[model samples]
Target chain A: MNSDSLWEVFINACLINNFVLAYFLGICPFLGVSAKLETASRMGVAVCVVMLVSSICAYFIHRVLQALNAPYLQLIAFIVVIASTVQLVEMFIKKASPTLFRALGIFLPLITSNCAILGVALFQTNKGYDFIQSIVYAFGAGLGFMLALILMAGVREKLALARLPDTVEGTAISLMIAGVLSLSFMGFAGLG
Target chain B: MQPEKPIVIRKEVVRRGSADEFLKGLWRENPVFVQVLGMCPVLAVTNSAINALTMGLATAFVLLLSNLLVSCLRHYIPPQVRIATFILIIATFVTVVDYLIQAISLEIHKSLGAFISLIVVNCLILGRAEAFASRNSIGRSLLDALGMGAGFTFALLCMGGVREILGGGTLFGVALFADNYQPWVVMILPSGGFFTLGAWLLLFNRIKQRQQRKQPRLQARLQEMGSEQ
Candidate 1:
């Protein structure tokens, strides 16, 4: 795990094992916020920022937890820190862009529950990636997530105008499209 | 006579209401098929039946315990910090379950990966905590947790069962078909998870639409019977 270069880690996290499409992380916001391209891009950016911040926090916290010899508190510690970070992000976003904040809505706080963020925290710790590797991994995962969300939003926008059966209209169609996207992502398996 | 009739009706209504609370999660408002609350575990760990069932049970355990704790402390927890407090309680339980699963079987633990910890993020559990458990009584929340947990398990099994059968030509590692039976390898991949869930959602939509179509007819027939009586 530690032998891989930063580029390999980035590629592995971004395209080969894309968070949303490949690992099934962050599906909630991926589906819920991807309805509009504008909102999706904003949400993706918000998530990317949160991921970057929380990833840094998690790295330092993990080191502290290790020094303290209280590994069991890792989950609780990570979550509490993530929650606080999200609160900060929420306030920042609200001040910077109220429309974006409103558009993001509950999902902003709900980012606390976005598994992709936590997954990065946990995966980084588990994979034993050092400081730089962890940052690159988070960046790659965030990029992958944003990429997936933007692509999904674009597809959904087109899908809205196309005629379709009632049963296949909503989440079912989205999942089907996501499945195809995931299949295409699988083609990147050899890249890393 | 009227007073007595009203009392009996009220008692029956209470009984039915309690039953509804429990029964609704099993089918009507399933956490997965209907509400689509937690998609990570639903898609991530369900590549095999055993993995799916284990994940389901682990999630149910967290959901059940968290619901119990949240309802018990509902009043003590203020509105502002309730979400954080709920998460703290949930993360504690997930940590416990994480170690518990690790102790039980390292291989299953490995297969489940960080998902055991990710239970903290499963919207279904937190949704229940915020939406149902925090507002409801202890007994009611307990029933809700059980029902939702069972429903979650049922849905995971549905996905796991199909995927395993088609993907591996086996159920719970037991080979069911002859040597020549070919497995659809895609059925077990990440994309397969999406496809299987989409298929399930489509089926559920169809069933719901059919039931809705029959509902008015059934209501009219009932009204006609009442008039005749």
Candidate 2:
């Protein structure tokens, strides 16, 4: 719990090693749901919220597992916890705001299986981040995810009008774009 | 008079088309190239030839087994619970692969790490099972899985081959030239994965375009002959 530099944690999470671009976590939604900016932003916010809560929850869960000497169950338990938490969130959102629920829709449940949420938990536990650091890291990671999604959405929106062959019209092209984006991100490696 | 006018009609037989269904996955609806379903592992583990092969084989095993099992029990599985069932089956196979990898060698297992475990969450496996396997027979499901798996593997290997050559200045860990060859270290980095994949895709698109151009002339000539008929 040597808690000191929070900004470093944030910068590291957001840029030096982006969740989507660098780490390759949460790519499912990054590609699947990032067709529109609005949806991508909403998904980003939702993922950020889940990351924050899960990070806090996982801190406790990690401690509990350590106490019980059952670290092996961490992955399975974390998944179950995240899934149930998402279910609760979905029910709450549905009861509270129908419009928002519709916007988020299937992605809410999708958060249950999203690797980013679990990745954050696993990473935080592995890194042994303090509470403040964990929160900052989660926020930064969420922002990073949002940044990548927005950029991708912007590119994809324009790409719609561009001429593409039938063979590489869809997924193949998207992957190629991701590859280029990944290459650009490499330039930022020396920044940190 | 009406009773004497009764006519017997033959029912159209619905035969299962196995090979067509399976072969379609190779190019028509390739999991990686066409559907782009499983990009996570495609981009992540394809930094090297060995990793690409390992990931490909592991995914194929899971995909094949899950497809077979899901197809076999498709009728009994309620629609609502089908996804859960498919995931559980996938997770079981992933666990088996994970342990088997660990038992065999630590280095390769370490390289693969969470990606192997994350196979349970790979949408491609569940996507195939729910969309294709659940509807087709067990045999057909296996073929489809094999085809899709092969396509995915082929795509991964292509990516890996390009990345390893440029990124590491070697192929399959073998040094092709002398030590003077300085590899573009960036290729080995995360960004290299994107560049290699994108370039390869652009190449694939160009080839496909050439093929499309050649198809219309052939089609037009066939139409001219049909008019004569």
Give the number of the best model, judged by DockQ: 1
Model 1, clash count? 0
TM-score of chain A of each: 0.94, 0.93
lDDT (Cα, tens digit) per residue for candidate 2, span B112-217: 7678877877878888998899998888889889988888888889888888988887888998768998888888788777667667766766777888999999
Docking class of 2: medium
Model 2 clashing residue pairs (backbone): A176-B198, A179-B194, A182-B191
Instruction: Summarize candidate 1's per-residue lDDT along B147-214 as a digit string, tens digits.
Output: 99999999999999999999999999999999999999999999999999999999999999999999
Instruction: Output the TM-score of candidate 1.
Output: 0.96
Any runs in candidate 1 off by more than 4 Å, and if so which?
A: A94-106, B1-9
- RMSD per prediction, one decimal? 1.7, 4.5
